[model samples]
Target: MPTQVIQAQPSTNAFSGFIQFWKDVKAVAQPYWYPNDSGDRAFSDVIRSWGMLFLLVLLIIALVSANLFNSFITRYLLDIIIEEKNPSKFSDTLVLFGLALVLVTLLSGFSKLLRKKIALDWYQWLNNKILSKYLNSRAYYKINFQSNIDNPDQRLSQEIEPIASNALSLSANLLEKILEMAGFLIILWSISQSVALILVTYTVIGNLIAVFLTQELNKINREELEAKADYTYCLTHLRTHAESVAFFRGEKQESNIIDRRFSNLIKNAKRKIDWEKNNEIFNRGYQAVIQIFPYIVFGPLQIKGEIDFGEISQASICCYFFANALGDLINEFGNSGRFSSYVERLSEFSDALKSVTKQPENVSTIKTVEENHLAFESVTLQTPNYEQVIVENLSLSVQPGEGLLIVGPSGRGKSSLLRAIAGLWNAGTGRLVRPPLEEVLFLPQRPYIILGTLREQLLYPNTNRQITDAELKDFLQQVNLQNLLSRVDGFDTEVPWENILSVGEQQRLAFARLLVTRPSFTILDEATSALDLKNEGSLYQQLQETKTTFISVGHRESLFDYHQWVLELSQDSSWQLVTVQDYRNKNTSITKTTGNTQLKIDSFLKDKFQTKLENSIGEGLSHKEMNALTSYSLSTIRSKASKGESITTNDGFIYRYNKDPKVLKWVMD
Candidate 1:
């Protein structure tokens, strides 16, 4: 299989392209991301985990109470040491404080462990659902066709995990934060009345900055996905034509292409880095301000006997609660930005698929043909780019058990006509009355070679439409492709046949396939062009024996003999359909006797130009006249002239010529 080299086509316009891309993504994600069944499940899981969240709340209360109790115990111990206060009471208080701290730490660990388990389960469930949706309804092919969006391969591969993973983790973290806020807010508010207000204000300020920075990062992430897909597309395209690149020595140029795409990616990444850096700077300063401000407001009160040391500790615990709640807000904001973008991308993919699958108006799928012959009633086909009709109002018919050689100059719609009949091309007018579609087989110029062994190639299209291996091998031998059997590892060998065999070999294999399938009529569109003359002759001979009616499109003059009728498409876009008998006249230039004495020379010229001669002679001649003319033999004419006379001249002896040439030669002599 020789690869055809093609330079990169123009980049689809960025603005228009991205708009469509975004639209497709939006369509895909809309139903999934909307608070529907899956969203409900996600919501339920977050709710279900609230039992552990409540336990976490209790753990926070215990930890805060234990610290306050420990502070009191410390003061009692100081009194005992300095003022001879009761030692037994002090020792008992210290023991209680240590036990409470241990119990609270264990409870918090258990809460964290339970929340983690629930988060992961939800993530897996949601991701599988998204994957299933993406796979259904031929969405993949429709997406590929309808949009210029790059690398759906990445959308399926990379984007999905992050979408599900981050979503689940963020949701779980927010839930825990809400519970933490509940546990701490009351205690902190009771302990430090006005200081609690300052904690809330600072938390709001810090989180707002984090949220804004994260939103910017989310934008960068979306752009990164697009950039990565673009880079992947180039690499895949390069792989598809690796041989062409090697032949053209384009490694350096391709490297530059890859490098330029990556550089754009790097710039986006740098912007994300800068945003994160600024965000961290604000976060650290805000965190320092919150940590010290809580202590500073409570410290003076405790010193002035306005509040106990235990009360100051409780205020610090309350600050932790409010901070945790604000953290949830920041976490939700970050994930909301990213998840929204994912939703947008997936939605666009789904919408484009829906639009594409809406079959064109008036496009009929010919399910069953109820006739003996296929007829194209004044069919006209137009090229998409050219907007010019390749075939116009061309009515043609092929009856059962009869054949036609569709002859035309290159690019004159011979193959296009077949494609229209096959129902692959829709830009055509006129009803093609087809007998059951299964009855017609079209072997294109370059036949498709699926990845399989020789046996699989023959058995394709009949996938499990069981045919014996022996019979398939026999068909292969008939097409002179028996050599393939030895080359193959075995009948079931799984190799890429398109790469393994040459195009000519593949066409021959297509013939083998045809023999097994044995449709009522076959159309060969230059199917034999790559084969040498002998194989072409043999294959056509096989078709004749099989009595398989065929419509062949080719410029090879040799095919004219195999077909009984030729339909030559004219430059004026008219069709001249004629039988072989119409080309039988013997007086045309093609029929003029040559003076080449060599046997091979005469045989070769006659074989090569015989069809042209027949056609030239038949153009204006009646079928009966043309037949009567070929029926007049050179042997019979020579025999009759020998019987009459030979007149000798200085140059040579002459037999009967035309009446005019005879008299004039005699007068000159």
Candidate 2:
């Protein structure tokens, strides 16, 4: 027996498809036409205020009337030339024809000018409204950081103008087409109802086919946008990390990554082009058929003497324009596809902005209040994803005229705690009582070097101050950045400060800004890490001289001298707070007791091994130093010492050289 064959049937529900297509179009268009805010409704506002709607209606009426009059004159002239053959009437007909032509041309030019003006006005208004909303809600940060939305910058900068301009232009064109179709339908039906019926049927069928062909275009367009954004992001990443890539000599690796992104973009673009090409081919064939169909229907009438040459010409013109007007969907399928994609992007971005600005319901946020002291009450901190807890029910406080230094191992939420204090991260429940925002200043480790003049840098986050040149220079001198002005050609000169200034210099400049502002509370998250001991001590001394109370996050023991209290964060989401003096006293006792034991161990090692103990241990002495000496953790060191794989002195320090004589020989050699 032969194998049975089955072929899939195409969807025959053209009516339902047509309805869905219209519904999709309406969904894209409704937001701009009828906006949530009356002020932002560009179309309605512009039409009402600019009198453009009235002008448009009048222009359409005049244009249609003039075309009818022109048609009438052509028919009359033909009748006279063919039937009456009067030369005198021919001159009169020519003059009437010239005048009608002139009137129509003037009306058409004026209408186009008016339409352009209205479209431009609407574009400007809508662009401003959308831009304001985007910036006001700080959606740029949310979209860039939190949301998966792609190419917000492109949507705002590139897509908005075209969306606004095309929306108004398409609406006007559609309205004009409607009027033209209505006016010409009468002429075609009077000539022959068969021509009118043929035109309508042809338009309906062509539009249905176009809609079906372009049904998946919106999905393809969105993919194209994503591919473009991906390629753009790749380029931006390369630019941002250019220095690192250059140092690593990884140009080939970066090139491969960029090539992959470009390849993906090309694939999507080719797919879009293929679909567009197919749509265009169909539209071109449809247009060719429209051109010849009228002549085929009306030629018989002219030959039979039922109509004159003028009647045939008028009927063809009327039928063609009427059919063209009704076949808008077929002609504008490509544009509609792109327009729908643009609408979806813009609407999604707008909604994302709204979502970012609105506070999440039923989620507990850190409640901040103004007070003289900076305190965290019953604070519980977690990652933004809530995957791990950082600080659990911790309470700490730092009063005026005091500084609190927060110390923790890496990944113990030291920076996150600072972010919580700065109000940037609000992932867990807490009551953080602190001074008002204006009264507090935060300086992160990597100082944000904005693009501006040196003066602007000093006055950042408060640009409307009345500080004199002398005062600004004094503050710069205090932070030891007095030479910055001379290097950058004084305060008013602008340069790329991030590139021009070293990291340490930028950090000091940040301190200079803090000194200038002199807020009641200052939070520093390893802000002095880039500075040497001298500069760091000087900056902290200046802070002490000022009225600004500060909370610092650092690992250096020197930081304890400047801070009044110490808050040490542990790995188990617990923290211990102690007075800085008490912590220093405890450490001092331990150090004194450990110092004698270390001396005894050093003497014994030197006497027995004939090696300099200082050279073996190197410069620094701490848990880190011990790890470097033993290549193991404190727990590993303790375990190995118990098993004689390492040796521990009375100071609780491990030496790997005792168990492995080869290690000591290698070090001494």
Candidate 3:
């Protein structure tokens, strides 16, 4: 999960760098400020935002002016105390100084408060904007394959707020410090232009150093952000696959994986620390040397009686404020590396969202058409990357109220075909005709457990369906999960259904959903694989009872009883669709792995399909005899009986049997 570091180009041109910086800034900020294309953000909102910002600007100006005024007042108060030494005069000037301090404090606090308020508002709008694109056009899913943009969840959840908040902080700090620097420079100018010019030269040199150092900080900040994302994602991956790890007893392997990521994070943290240390040393040294500028220029003047001692004191205060203001500006510039890092990241994320969400123009992809029935017309499905063809030049259709089962050898695109039908994969040339997605329900092997009440679990994909308590209980009973209600508080109770229920139980619960919503067309992807034949048959019976047109992907021959037709996909990309009976007979020929010859499975089962005519008895059939008679191998019979399914023998020696110790059972067709 560790993201690859993108090195900053050290020789990047100044003009080109400014151009890129402006593009990143505009991409991130313009949508919030401009009403056009921001459908959700209104013009009135824009006006109000600009108005608040204007007030904030005024507040900053007022705050800086108050600081300058107080500096002069402190000088006057000192002159009175030192020269006049009269308590009455000093008391009046001291009161004036105290009032000035109060003004400065109020202005400073209000400005900061306003700045935060504006920043928060911008964050709200930008989060929603990015979130919309992330969810739109399945970008949330598609963005994962894009390796360049890592940890979108981290970006959306953590990085987004910083863009708005830091942009405001950077601007406000830059504005306030610049104002202070300018005001102090004017104060110093009145005293001596030569001294003011010297200080200006120092400020210019300091800015040049900050610019160079900030570039290095930019690289460090970027790596730190990426490393943190990688570390956080590793922890999340462990949580998700905790069960798999426990099953394999892979704690050591998992620990090593996490440790590797942690080491990278720690390494990046160390580099950042080193950079901060060097930057801090430079900052302190720069400030230490600037402290004596006033003494160098005006200390001799005060001794010569050219100016009052008070003027000397005022000059030193002005120099301190001036240097401190310039230092704050330089510090902010250095910190802009972090700001620019965030800006570039957020801008790239936004652009990537836009790119992935956009529907490709004039691209060759499968076109989906909504209709009352399901069909594929000359549909050739390819993997999303177009790297390999799943099935080529294929055509098939499922009639209304009919069931179609897709079967194939392992890795023959059986599941991929279903994905194409569901509109999840549509990379190849095709026209897929199916019912509207809302009317279709897809149940995969692993049922998705939404975070909500038990009722929501059953009523998923359509939670608003009003099913009475009695009706819900009936649905549960139909799936043989009536006992589920006893274990829970009620149908409305919320629990982590996944961990609370076993795989078989989860599958049955998914069938319970089929009963609740009863979608017009259901597509199941080995939905009942975890369940035994008895449970699987029970669910499929309910599925047939619902009379919904369904397509199922599974390897079990028991699925033959539920579906009307079988669409077998061969490894060579050839396909054949026929009745379930014909498919059962035909499949024995399709696979040569077992043997050269195939038993006519239907010919053997058709004559002995009956199980209710009489109860099975005796040592029904020997393993070899049964394989010869019913074309059902001993392994198949053992597999069937292990799951406790009813057995029918072809010899008419036994009809149906369960727990009959003498009989070797095989499930009936």
Candidate 4:
């Protein structure tokens, strides 16, 4: 068969892309202008509560008045110097000029101070608002785990400050320039209409060219930001996985990865610099032309005596200020591009937070009740992707003070079922009835070692509760962690607990927390995987002593002694539930054979005792199987044969079992 090639559609032209970019910019800015509940209150609150509008009006008035007064003084000084012809009049002119200069300076300084204060206030308010939403809504988790939004940490930590500061500064400066332009345009037009016309035409054309030249600047900035974030993420990843990398001696590999990320960052940064450089060239030329163009236009009139030296000088000053103010868009084009990029990122982050925080409408949630029971009714469990059904139509319940053990092969959704019961996973149609969130606690295999003092670690997830040192000490003793107090310099000492404590020690500490809190219900997902049998038995005994109910997902046969019931999950979303004793009886039944044949019952026994064999597989055989297979005593053989398979021939009966030779020999001895 001939191969067929498919081509991608061509990209949009610059004009269409530019239009789309502006549309996106407007969409990002719309929330700031017309905010909803999810939007930050800082912008609206600052404008309303801080008298920002009033301040802005005052600032504009002060700036325009100051510039007008300065222009008047310039004209007055020139006129007096040229026509005075008297030393006494010159001294008076000098004194008047000094007073006007001081007044203009004061007004300008006061206006600048007000602008700075407003900007600072907005910065602080917006930062607090963004942080409040980011944390209070739990957007951090959604962004990190559930959403495709990148670098929320950077967006929240780094981008927010600049957004607040630059947005305010740019808006204030732009407003002031507009006011200044209005004041100067009047002065320039009065001096010479031709100069004013030329100034307006030049500024308009220059800004138009700048807009087209820097149209792609925002896209470049966004790419640069992403590259920088990627590089930072790589460095952070290396630090987080430092132990794994060290064990594998992957320093060179990690360095190569870092170098690749840095290279990408540098490439994007170079593009940004080059774009800005080209932009700066255009702005600088436009600025230089604004300076000299007025003189060139009016120099002929000055030489012809139609306009005096003072008139030319005054026109030049007014024309320069007016043209510069009009050219604000051209001069600050790069900053505007950067600001737009910041706004786009922050706006997207805000939108993501809003979407994540908003409760899904018309979606069923695992309804939690105030009762002391956990129940699942016709629950169908599936992965988050909904690609595979893990458990189907499963119904079970555990009352207060009763324990349930969930057992299944690996990847059989054992842990996912626990998550659903805990209200973390809700991808399928199911009704889960559990105690209120506050009354339940979940302890996974690897206990979470929070960064804090030992006392704080015990009191975590419940930090506000006040407990005496004696009570904390007693709880530590209950979990066999009393030595932790002295080893870590008492409860108040702060250390990196995850690094300082062994995994077994951490698991014990987590159990200590359980004892201290005494939650109404607890869910343990292999929570005892790090502890030995003795320690595990002690912890379970402690739980049995309490009125707290728990459901455990484990593969330890010893755990069977603690749980009253077993919930076995099988393939094809099938499951079975039976009392612990009944399950043991079914698996321990013996099969008798009458013919002269070798019976193979390992496959059947393996399925029944797989959970126990996983941890107790001594040299590829279970401890019980080793003893039964190697025993020489007829009594032991009969007892072991009762729980396994046997064959009887015409001459005699033969017994055989699978186990390790060493353990079998030891049992025989």
Candidate 5:
């Protein structure tokens, strides 16, 4: 898959952007709050959620009202100080203010707690809902073909909680601030109408500017999200392919890739910080200027004996609060931009999943039928996209207790046929008759070692099937993993099985699963590739004893002894099925016996290099001769020599002794 550095553009129309953001919020929120038939949603859960929200709103109202009461109390205390100047009345008024303060604090705390509780519940439900859809109908597997959807794991693990939490925070903040604004504005109106009207004009202008700034912020937040995902995916890719990178000594190249990704992330972060710097200046400046408006309006009135200092102070306090509320709204508008980005991303992910879950109506797909055995009837297979035909009208079947080995040159669609049997691909014209998937087990080239305890590893895909530890050890011993228990504590010990087990050991352990499962039909795609002849033979012998019909994709000549039929595919989308003995006789080039071990046709090509490159008289081999005899192409040979693997003379020759090349394989004892 190609790497995608997706950048989102700012919405051109600010009003339309807000309208879309609101619709997106409803789309995201509906699944959780309004009960849907999905397993993740419940009517009872919805009711409980609404009840919590209802209580939260009541607390917010109480807190807002108490704050309004406190502002009025501050005005009353000021009037007593500047006008009455009675110490006993002032002390009593202070007690009332203190009581109101305690009530507001209590309301504020509970309101916050309830908001968090609701968001926490929302996070769990949304995560579960998305996860179910992601895993359903093999959407997780099919989604990989989509390059547009990047870093799904990052989206699932990191992006989900923020959606839940931020939604609540943005909504509650907007609600509380709006209510406070209305109350303070009412206070301003009662004290002085002119000042309140001027403040309202200032608020409208501030909001217009906020909408434009926030739209820009929305673009930045989206870019930042993708940048972070890209950088995270880069690190994860390095970790997954660490062994391959180490073998190639690709640290410099890998580091360059990581640095590039990280730099992109840093660039987005810096851009956001810059936008925030400008946004803060606007927000603070708007509030700072509002601080003097009330004093300016009423200062001349006090000189004319129309009002006292207490009235001026009260009007100023109300004006300050009203502007502060508007300032908070501007900040929330910025956060709403980030909120918009989250909602947009998750909506895209969910829509993609729903789409891929359904089959394409217009496209022709191979029909599947579940039967007692395996067979392909007049099957013409194509790639998933129907880009190329793999085989034309191919027909074959395996008997109830027989083995069929698929052999072909590399890239001849051998494994692609197994995929058809597994029902992973079906974009073609044919009828694929096979046993129920539950009764068929597929072992790929690299066996999947699931994360679990030693016992769980052995009994994967059916861990609930009870089996004695002693019997499991017997199965392990059958696969030549007898000392595995000694290395670990026992069957219950859980380690990183993939890291701890060698490729050969992991393959053996995969075969050990066959013994445990004993499925009626089995498909092996180079399942024993990592195992030596001894272990391969032992496992194949065990498989034969199970009396299960199996189809294997293997190039080994020795594998012919284990199977009755050979299915050979050609690069030109042609195939021929014949008896194993006849196949061996007809294609002598494919099967070569090297001592007791059989070398694959490609390996036989490499084995000849031992004799061909032999420096019998201590004479160097020319580049042409080395390139002709070795498995690697001339381009590959030149690349390796250029990288200091070999020192060649100006004449393009490498000197060596006996049958050994100048470069020797380093074996760690």
Candidate 6:
């Protein structure tokens, strides 16, 4: 069977980056709210952890009520002592009230400590839940590339801590206020009916004002969040690419751009800060006026013989509770606005992520097609920025063990075609029958190398695949990279793979990976562009020996000879699969791998290397000899050299020796 090529029409990706991120957060949070779910379980675990505080609330309430009763007795005894001169009774009453005060103070202190302890644990639980989701879902990648979720690191690390702490404290405070209002409102109503009416009016008016204030605060907060994200993004971007700027000598240019971004952020942030400062000023004044309100309303009534001492004391407690509850309204309302904005942002982000792929109604199981054979019928592909087709479906066939090269001017969707085949670019309509995705390897122009040891670089995506340490070293030698093997400890050694390897070295590493994994087919999209001609030709020649089906996208003319056929993308929105009859003529003497002149080939390569440095021994090694050295079977030459042993091939190629001229020539060269 032959490989088929189809020209595809592009489709736009409509998913909003911000909306998708919110969806992911909700998908993570919703199940936690479920009673038996892990999230719910974690929340429940919080209750147990704070059980002491929960119990203390009951004790605190009892102590407070008892202390309020003692206040009534103390007030009555003082009145009797002043009016009737009953000194002994007043003294005993004073002693009893003092005892009640001591006990109440002790319990209140203990409960406050317990509350603090519980609050810390709740904060930790919420933090863990949010951070876990960010780390696990490859959400970091989605946030960076697919979503407009600006500065997720800031969102997770800084924004989350405040959200969690404030949410828990506000919830607990609200519950306590509700209990106080319920218990005391009834007592105040009985003692001073007129005052109760006034209290209710004040409560209603205060809450309305607080609600209005909070709505305005939300507008300010939303702007603040956006500005903060922008500032954080600039800082993070600056730090991440600091090394790049330093290496390129472009620090001033980068610094100026960052300064502009920061200035914009600061301009917006000042507005938020001014709004917050004004609101807080008003809130503090309102809170101060509310503090002494209890004494003002009920004191005159008690003096005029309107109510008994017990009734007066009860009215005072109720008035205080009512006034404080009104004050609480402002704080809770402000917090609710902040929380709502966060939720809305989260919800919108989720919506976008869910729409990443038009939920496949029935995803057909993908199968790996046989070598050099691809079948795509009615294929179309699209990108977000363009309405035109990236590629439109048409057909061509390629036989097994054959190479098909794609060449075109830039932005022709040559690389995109490979991505679509890999299932990374899903914004397309097509029946793309490919070999099992795992059976093929796609190497991009700049391959991503994760931070890890050399072995890790080689065994990527198949980390658990059984590969020996010795096998890894041999692979490195085949790519003429034996020097790196010593610096690396093992496959598990952690290092920044991208920084340690040069662009060309990284491509060679990718090729080294090809030899180890041995996929049935390989796609190279400017994979060798970073390498010089010699290394590039060497990589292609190595690919030839494996008889692996090759689909390449490059403008390099040297690559044309390796393939039996070439697929040229045309400006007319079509492709040409032309057979090259003159392929043999294009082949250079150096590239011809096997011939009767094997020894002659070695001498020729030796001569080529001599021209670079006259003092160098065996400077030019023939391409065939180089190929023989890189092949898997003769990899022992590298291991032998590392072990300080003299070794040579029977075909007159001495790999590691100092004494013999031929051996010294191979070693020094």
Give me the candidate number with maximum lDDT: 5
Regions of model 1 farther than 4 Å from truth = 1-193, 215-234, 249-293, 296-338, 345-349, 357-372, 381-390, 407-412, 426-429, 451-457, 467-489, 568-574, 580-669
For each candidate in turn, the TM-score is 0.61, 0.73, 0.84, 0.75, 0.79, 0.62
Runs of candidate 6 with Cα error greater than 4 angstroms are 1-176, 203-227, 236-281, 300-318, 359-387, 390-393, 425-431, 451-455, 480-491, 580-669
Q: Name the TM-score of candidate 5.
A: 0.79
Count: clashes, candidate 2: 0
Ranking by lDDT: 5, 3, 2, 4, 1, 6
**Which window of 10 residues has the lowest lDDT sum in candidate 4?**
1-10
Residue-level lDDT of model 3, residues 1-669, one tens digit each, is 112234345336888877788888988888878655857578899999999999999998899989988878877888888788989989998898989988988998899899999999999989998899889877787666433687788789988888888888888888998899889889889988998898789867986887788888878777888898898998998898888989999999989988999999999989989989998998788776667777777778877867776776677778778877776777777777667777888887877777655555655788899999999999988876667788888888888889999998999898898778777678889799988888989899998889999899989978898889999999999999999988889988998777789888988999999888888899999998999777887788889888899999998777877889999888888888899878756654454225655434465453453332232242343344455545355555555555555444445443332455644443233
Between 2 and 4, whose lDDT is larger? 2
C-alpha RMSD of each candidate structure in angstroms: 12.6, 10.3, 5.5, 8.6, 10.1, 11.1
lDDT, each prediction? 0.63, 0.74, 0.79, 0.73, 0.81, 0.63
For residues 1-669, could you state the per-residue lDDT of candidate 4 as single tens digits?
111112122237967646655664565544444466555455656357457657766766876787777787777777778865577877887788788788878877877777676656655665676677788655665455445677778787788777666766677777778788888888888887877887888778887887677667768867987899899999999988999999999999999999999999999989889998988888788778887776787778878877766677777788778767766645565576567667667666766676666656655444444566889888887654456788998888898899999998998999998878765667677678888878888899999988888888999789777999999999989888888877778888999998778899999999998988889999999999888766887899899998789999998776876899999999778999999977765554432233555545587675754433344333343344443333223333433433343422212324334444454411111
RMSD of 6: 11.1
Better of 3 and 5 by lDDT: 5
lDDT of 3 at 163: 80
Better of 4 and 5 by lDDT: 5
Best by TM-score: 3
List, residue by residue over 1-669, the lDDT tens digit for candidate 2. Answer: 111112122237977745654564454455545566565565657456348757876886798789877877887888788888899999999899999999999988988888777767656766776687778745555455445666677777888777666666677677777788888888888988987888888878887887777667767877888899899999999998889999999999999999999999999989989998988898889887887776787777778887787777777678667767777635464576566556656666666666665666666667877777788999998765466788999897788888889888898998888878766666678798877778888998999888888888999889778899999999999999888877878888889998788899999999989988888889999998988767887899899999678989998766765888998899898998999867766654665466567423355533533333446544223333344333244543433433344444333454553334334221221
Model 1 clash number: 18
